[model samples]
Target: MIRHLVLFKLNDGVGRDEPRVIAGAQAFRELDGLVPELEFWECGWNITDRPIAYDFAINSAVADGDALTRYIEHPAHQAAAGQWREFATWVIADYEF
Candidate 1:
């Protein structure tokens, strides 16, 4: 399986409670059942108050590179990512485990 991890940092002026941020987060939370290539899904806000920590994170797993690609290209995923693009920037990592 491949583990896909994402870490998000909100834009300089954005807040977690802002409607747009809330909605974007909700969109991702809803993707677990919407994308067929997502075999596992977990996401949430960061609990730490450190500068190095990202504001949000997504911890997921898929069958392989192909599955990971499908998950990334899925419409629901694309839409959710688009929402985040307006208020945050993120980094991702994928590895076999």
Candidate 2:
């Protein structure tokens, strides 16, 4: 399986309580139900206030690279990502397990 992890940092001055940010996070939270290629999905806002910590994170799994690709290309994922792009920047990593 492929473990896909993402760390998201909100842009300066963008708080997590903002409606747009809340909606964007909700969009990502909905992906597990909307994307069939996802074998696992977990996402949430960070509670830590440390300067090094990201504002949000997502941990997901899929069968393989192809499945991961399908998850990335899924319309729901795209919509969520598009919404996030307006207020945050993210970094991702994928590894096999």
Candidate 3:
């Protein structure tokens, strides 16, 4: 098994960033159908204080490294990530089983 976790800090330079973040979260949360290896999906805003925490984050579970790679390279993921470029300033990760 593999746990793929990511955190995102919104650029907030664009006026529409909040909505984009919400939409992106919704899209990613619904990716189980698009990627068969996806075991679980969760995303939300960060209202707590953590050393490296971002405004938004996602924690997903996959079958293995290959599934993780497939999830990252999938077209549906590509579209979701492309939207991040406009509103995201930083990303953090911690991937392990």
Candidate 4:
């Protein structure tokens, strides 16, 4: 399986309560059922206030690298990610398990 992880940090002057952020998060939350390649999915805001912490995260898995690629290229995923492009920056990691 391939595990895909993402961490997002809002840009300076951006806040979680903003409409775009809320919609972006909602878009991610809805993807588990929308994307067929997802074997597992979880995402949410960071509860901790530590300086090293990211503001949001996504934990997801797929059958293999091909499935992972499909997930990444999926149109719904593209739109969700596009929302963040304007207000946040993110990092991602993928590994086989």
Candidate 5:
């Protein structure tokens, strides 16, 4: 399986409490049911107050690279990512297990 992990940082001047941020987070939270390629899904806001900590994170899994690609290209995933682009920047890493 492929483990896809992402760490997201909100843009400068953007707060996690903002409506758009909240909505963006919600969009991610809803992806599990929307993307059939996902074999596992876990995501949420970060609670740590450390400066190095990202504001949000996604920990997910898929069958393989092809399944991961399908998950990335899924309409729902695209939509959520588009929404997040307005307020955050993210880094991702994918590895096989």
Candidate 6:
């Protein structure tokens, strides 16, 4: 199993923080149906850290490296990611377990 956790930091003046984060969460939620190897998917804001930490985060579970690859390479995911890159800092990490 692998827990592919990622955090996204947004650039300044991109948009209102909550709305941008909500849009990202909605976008990530779409991957569940589109990516076969995506066993589980969730997204949320970093409330405790407030304005300090990354704006939002994603939690994904995959079966293995191959599964992770599928999720990363899926066309739907690619499209979603392309849009995210316009506003985000960078992908945090792919945690394999």
Q: How accurate is candidate 3 locally (lDDT)?
A: 0.75
Clashes of 3: 0
RMSD vs true structure, all candidates = 0.6, 0.5, 2.6, 0.5, 0.6, 2.3
Q: Clash totals for all models, in order?
A: 0, 0, 0, 0, 0, 0
Per-prediction TM-score: 0.97, 0.98, 0.77, 0.98, 0.97, 0.81
The residue pairs that clash in candidate 3, if any, are none
lDDT of 1 by residue, 1-97 (tens): 9999999999999999999999999999999888988889999999999979899999999999899889889989999999999999999998999
Per-residue CA lDDT of candidate 6, range 30-90, in tens?
8876788988888776676666678778888999999888888999888778778777775
Model 5, span 1-97: residue lDDT tens: 9999999999999998899998999999999778999999999888779979998999999999999989999999999999999999999999999
Q: Which parts of model 3 have CA positions greater than 4 angstroms off?
A: 12-17, 49-52
Give residue 94's lDDT in candidate 3 (0 to 100).
43
Against the reference, the lDDT scores of all candidates come to: 0.95, 0.95, 0.75, 0.96, 0.94, 0.77
**Model 3: how far residue 7 lies from native, Å:** 0.1
Sorted on lDDT, best first, the list reads: 4, 1, 2, 5, 6, 3
Candidate 3 or 6, higher TM-score? 6
Candidate 6 ranges with C-alpha deviation above 4 Å: 17-24, 49-51
CA deviation > 4 Å runs, candidate 4: none
Q: Where does model 1 exceed 4 Å of error?
A: none
CA shift of 39, model 4, Å: 0.2
lDDT of model 4 at position 94: 96
lDDT of 3 by residue, 2-89 (tens): 7888878766465434687678777776776777777887777788877776777778889877887888899888888887777786
| Residue 22 displacement (Å), model 1 | 0.3
Model 1, residue 55: displacement in angstroms?
0.3
